[model samples]
Target: MLSTAAVSWKEPNVECSIDIGLCPNIKYKHKTAQRRLTLFEDFVAFGGVCVSWRLVMAALKKDFNMLPRVPWLMLAEKDDGSNLRDFYCPMKCKNIYRSMLPKASGKRFFSSQGWLLTIAADHEVNLLHPLSRVQILLPNLTTFSNLEEMATHCTDKLYHNFIQKAVLSSSPSTTSDYAIMVIHGAISKLAFYRRGDNAWTTIETWLSAYSDVIYHEGRFYAIDCWGRIVVCDVNGSCPTRGQIMPVMPNEFTHSLEKLYLVESLGKLLIVLRQGVTTRDDYTHGTTRLRVFELNWEEVQSLGNRALFLGFNSSFSVEASNEIKANCIYFTDDCFEAYYSASFADEGAPNYHPEGGGKDMGIFNLSDGSIEPHFRGRSFDPLSPPMWVTPSF
Candidate 1:
C-alpha cells in the first residue's frame, strides 16, 4: 500500500494541484490532476526498487512526451540479474518487457498487428499481448542444428555459422495470413508459419544470399548477396514454391552488412550497408549506405557515410575489413537510425583501432550526421533497456 499526500499551490491569481506519488516534491499539471492522483494512489509498491521506479517515470517523460499519470507496474528483468521482477512505471510506458526478453535468453519477440511474436529456442513461437500478457503459441515447430560429426571434425566452426541473419515478417495470403522468416546461412531458407494452425514449412534454395528481410505491399522482399532484389508473393495459397520475382532494374551486389526496412512516402524503402573501399595510400576506410525504392529502380548511396562508427577513417583503403554491427534500431518516425559501434570482428588486430568511438549513437538522415551517446556502465547498469514488444 502507498501512502499519499497532496500539495496545493497558489500564486498571483493562479492556482494548481500537485498530486504526490512515491517520489517527493513531484507535481502534476492541474488539468491532468485526476490521472496523476490515480498513479500514485493505485500503484506505488513500498518495497519495490526505488531507482527503477524513478527511472521509469523519467523515461516516460523523455520518450513519450507525456506526464506520469498512473503508475503501472510491469514485469521486468531485474538489473541484479534476478530473473523477473515487478516494477512500476507511468502507465503509458510502451512495450516495457520487449527489451528484457533478449536478456532472459528464453524467448525472442517480434512485433506485428499490435501484438508480439515470441519464439523459444526450439522455435516454439507464441503471440503475446504486451499489456495483458496474453499469449498463444503457434503450433508449428522447426529446429536447425549442424551435423555433430562434421562440427567436431572441422577445426573451424561452420555448422553454427549456418545463417548469419534471421528476421520475421507477416504476409497476407488469399486463404489467410502467415509469418515469413528469412534465414541466411550457407544456404538461404524461407520458413513460413501459418497462424491458427501453429505449423511451420520451409523452402530451401541456393540463393546463398545475405540480406535484410522487408515486408512491403503485402509481400516480403530482400536484396540477396548477389545484389539481386527478390520479392516473394506471399498471397499465394500454398507454401511459396514458385520462382520469386525480381523487381530491381539492375542487379546491385555489395558486401551488405546491415539491412533496414522503412515504409515511407507511401512505398517501402530498403537501406543497405556495404563496406567502404580503402585507398592505396590507406588514408581512410569507406562504407556505403544504399537506399532502394520498392520498385528497385533508383538505388542511391548516402555517400561515404560511416554506417557503423568504429570503422570510420581507420582502415587502409585497399585492405579488406569485415565490419561488425552491434544492434540496429530506428526511431519511431523512421526518419533516423541508431546503431551500436561494436562489430563482429573484435579479435582482428586493426579492429576498432579507434577504441570503438561510442557505445551507442543516433543518426539523423535529415542532417546526415550522427550524434554519439556514450554512457558508462556505472551510470545505470540496470536502467531499463529500451523497447521490447511481446509477440502476439
Candidate 2:
C-alpha cells in the first residue's frame, strides 16, 4: 500500500530585478585575478548567493568546469500563488516599468543611432529613446499589409510557416532601417520592412528552405532552409550584386540554421551551424556551432567544437562587446523563452521554441570556452552585463 500524501513544491517570491552598471572589487571563487570593466557598471549581478572561492572551485572541479563570477538572471519562487516577479540587481530607479518585466522574459530592447526599437509578439511595435519615455507605435503593420493582400497571406502563413530567420539591419543610406524576415515551410521569401516606407517588400529570389542570415561587410548573407546560402548587397556595390554566393556543398546532414557576422578584436567572424549526426545514422537534428573568418584575403573556418543548441533548430544569434573578458552575448530566442511557464509546451516532441528561449550562453572567443550563463532559476543579472564604452 502507498501513502496518499500530496507532493507539492513550495512557491518562491520570484521578486528580483537588475540595474545594469559597473562595480569594482568583484572577486570570484576560482581565481585570484580581479577583473574590472571598462564601462564602469557594464553588468549588474542579480539573485545569486555569494559563496567563498574555495567552495566554488570545488563545485567546478566536480562539474569539470570553471565557475563564472557573473550570472545572467536569477529566479525565485513567488510567495503567493499568482505570477512570478523579478527584482533586478546592480539596482535601478525602482520604476513601475522595471518591476513589470520579469528577469527571464520580455521583448528584447535594441538601441541604436539615438533610436530604440522594441518588439514583442503580443504588443504593438514601439520606437523610442531610452532616456525618454515617449514612444510611438509604428504605423499599423496590419493596415499596410492589408493594402496589398500580403497581410492575408502573411497572416495565414504565420499559423503554418516557421520563422527560420529574422534580423535588423541598417542600410548604408542611413535614412532607413529594415527588419529582414525569412520563413521556412512550403515556400521561401526574403521579406524586408523599410521604416520610412511603411510597407513590406517580399522577394522570391531564394528558395525559403534552409536557414541563417548575417550582415557582413556591405551585404546581407542568408542561408535558407534548403542548405543554400544567398548573399545580397544591401548597398548594391558588389560585382555579383544581389547574387547568392554558393560556398560549402550540402553533403552534410541537416540544413544550416545560423550565421554570426562577429566583429571581434579587429577581425570579422562568420559563424555557422550544421546539424549533428546520430549513432544510428539518423540525423538527430541537433546543430553544431562552427566559426569562420570573413575577409577578402581568404575565408577560413575556425574551431570544430559541436555545440548542442537543443532545439529542432529555431534560434537567434547576437553578439555583445566582451569589453573586458572578450566574450559573446547571445539572446538565443526572439521571445523570452528563458522565463514563463505558460510558454512551455511539454506535450510537444521537441518542446522548445525555435528562435527564443533555450539555454542562453556567452562563448569566450578569446579562449574558445563557453561562459557559465543562465544559472539558478532566472537569468543571473551578472550574465548580460552593460556594455558601456567611455565616450571620451
Model 2 scores a TM of 0.48
Candidate-wise lDDT, in order: 0.35, 0.35
Model 1 lDDT tens row, 13-53: 11223233544444545423323322221222211224544
Top lDDT: which candidate number? 1
How far off is residue 99 in model 1, in Å? Answer: 8.9
How does each model score on TM-score?
0.49, 0.48
Model 1 bad stretches (over 4 Å): 1-79, 84-105, 108-116, 119-123, 139-186, 247-255, 275-288, 295-360, 373-392
RMSD of 2: 13.8
Writing each residue's lDDT as its tens digit, candidate 2 over 140-224 gives 3342322344344445323222233344454212334444333323344554444564644455554554445555555566655
Candidate 2 residue runs with Cα over 4 Å from true position: 1-123, 128-136, 139-166, 171-188, 233-241, 251-257, 264-268, 274-288, 294-331, 334-356, 364-371, 379-392
- Give Cα distance to truth, residue 94, candidate 1, Å: 13
